[model samples]
Target: MKKLLILLLLPLSLFASLNIAVTYPYIGALTKEIGGEHVDVEVLAKGNWDPHFVVPRPSLITKVRNADALIMNGAQLEIGWLPPLIRRAGNNKVTPNASSFLNLAQHIELINKPNSVDRSGGDIHPDGNPHFHLNPANVITLAEVIKDFLTKLDASNSEIYNTNLLSFKEKWEKKLLEWQTKMESKKGLKVIQFHDNLAYFNKAYGLNNLATIEPLPGIPPSSKHTIELIKLIKEQKPCCILHDVYHSTKTAEFIQEKTGIKIILMPHDISALDSIEDLTSLFDYLTGAMQ
Candidate 1:
């Protein structure tokens, strides 16, 4: 094929370039940062579509099918949509065991793994909490993973990926320190969450998670749970009740009606809301809500 020959004859820098596809905007944004200008990234899902609730669109299918590599957060964060997309992408490069297939959750410690293995027990991730992105430290770990992945897939430019990763990690680490300081100075700031999804973020901010609005992570927030949340809010007197934007506003509205505490809606991912387009904006809006 003429195109294939062109690809081969191109310089290592040119040939090493790739079209990467990611499951969500957050991962895509990070990959773009680490991959730099060498890779063209296509984010499959929009931010508001709860990463767990994505319905693969034709565009996403096309992107995945044509991508040289597919990057994901793993840990079942994509259980709902990714599997179908992978099948649809029809890209052999993304198949497990392929050199270009990278699962970012690799080697990261997971929390809240289920003891049982039955879906009938309610929606559960046997792989544990997939909310690792909420913590900036995990991002640092994953950037290295991406850096390595890119280098392996395109070894000629290994130094570029490595350099970008180091710079990004250094920048992110400094920001993390400042955020930790902000959280520590505002100590004893407890809060109740709509679900356990915000655990890592709460931990990062040093906020005390007194309780959750849902008894179980995947279980829908119920009347009984809200009653419990109201009591907990009364007892802890948290300045805010943090809820992801994808959650039911009615439940939050009801809670606000009974308890006069402010309910803060934060994006759980880069694309969680329309205006919260990128990582910096997402962090800025979320950090602002905490303030």
Candidate 2:
């Protein structure tokens, strides 16, 4: 009877999956891709919402409380909302100091580090721009980081994680080549944006970001800024306004009426739009949007 009981419990231990809580849809997607059958991912935020502003809800607390590990975009992207969730959940495993906690920003070299900290700058990220994942090359780096993180946490399935990482890297490298070829002709294309969220993407594809609709980050468009932008647009003659889906297009539309510039809605993460179902589709839409 004792031998039969031991045999029954052995498979359960081998097949158990780690429940990982990720702060955003993209992280959740990446974790699932690498974790495969060995991990269960719980995404805390919706992709369509602004990554800077998430409403910490009771349900998110429960998810964090139950997670075996937690992953975040870091670099202060979640500064507004995530800290509250972590405090409320009281999950040591998900705390920043814990071994189970993973801050993706720590692994990647962040860009746009501010020279000084001030609320007058309109919600600047002290560490840097947290949207490093927008660059496809950084995506590969993130995959490697996640692979090592998983291996460290669950050595029992290290081989499986390694295999998954290799497969992802091979496929992504091919996609990178394809994206580069598609964007080759669009190099040095001048464009406007509602916000500077696409800094990494523009840098990756060599798109020149002329200016933003807003006067500053996290600030709304003003009539003074709008008139100035109109003048700049007529002078600079940018291709279009690459607007984010969450913000209202009223300002961009007004600019279009005055300047006859185009407006293109850009999705920042997986499921950010209905068409963006996964990582591949997200980039596919983004790279194809110029046409």
Candidate 3:
């Protein structure tokens, strides 16, 4: 009878995993990779939507409220939506200052910080670009940060997280080298984009972006700006228009109609397209899209 009782209790102990909530799909993927079997991750934002424009739905409040910890991309990427959810959830552990809260952006250096903070700049991030995860190197660094975070949060599972971290690093290092080689031939290639969403990606491969279809970040396309872009495309003869998934392709299609330039779809996150399932696959698709 005692042996039977112990066996029943064993299943309950095994289910004592930590519940982690993340603001983006990439963070959720990284947390799961490091947390292994010791955590249950709840992602608040859909991978298909704009990372900066996630809706803080009531359902997300439940996710945040129940989470034992929270991890976010931060750098004000969540400024538009996460705050309301956090406020409503009333989960102190997930608050900005809590030890249980991890902001991945603080650990990495961001690029393209605006010279001035104003609506005129079209929704610029004052702390710089928050899309650091698009860079493979930054992803590796974030992975280590997440591993350390999980280790500290659940010390009993530190070994598992550490082991997973080492394995992930090995695999990622190899893939990085492969991507570097793949992108080598495309260096110094000029491109255009609807937004500067691919800034990190462009920097990674030396893809020069002459201009964007949008007059400024987060602003809709204007006919006057489109005319200017059409003129620029004629003069610059850029390789292609790198358009993000969530945004409409109408402007880019119009540009292509005018200039005969190609428009390539660039996905910013996993599930931004049906084919992009995970971190490596996301980068793989981006690198492959260069052609």
lDDT digits (tens) for residues 192-272 of candidate 2: 999878889999999999998987667799999999999999999999999998999999999999999999999999999
Clashes in model 1: which pairs? Answer: 47-271
Of the candidates numbered 1 and 3, which has the greater TM-score value?
Answer: 3
Which has the greatest TM-score? 2
- Per-candidate TM-scores read 0.90, 0.96, 0.94
Residue 32's lDDT within candidate 3 is 90
- Which prediction has more favorable lDDT, 2 or 3? 2
Worst 10 residues of 1 by lDDT: 179-188
- lDDT by residue for model 1 over 1-291, one digit each (tens)? 999987777766564568998888888888889888789998888888777778888887898998999888888888888888888778899876788888887768887787876777566466888888887777788778888888888777788998898898888888777777656666668887877777777777677888777667777887887888888778878887788888787887788888898888878887687788777677667766787
Candidate whose lDDT is highest: 2
lDDT per residue as tens, model 3, 216-262: 78889999999999999999899999999999999999999999999
Alpha-carbon runs more than 4 Å astray in model 3: 1-14
Computed on alpha carbons, the lDDT of every model, listed in order, comes to: 0.80, 0.92, 0.91
* Candidate 2, poorest ten consecutive residues by summed lDDT: 117-126
**How far off is residue 127 in model 1, in Å?**
2.2
Task: State which candidate, 1 or 2, has the greater lDDT.
Answer: 2
Q: Whole-model lDDT for model 2 versus the true structure?
A: 0.92
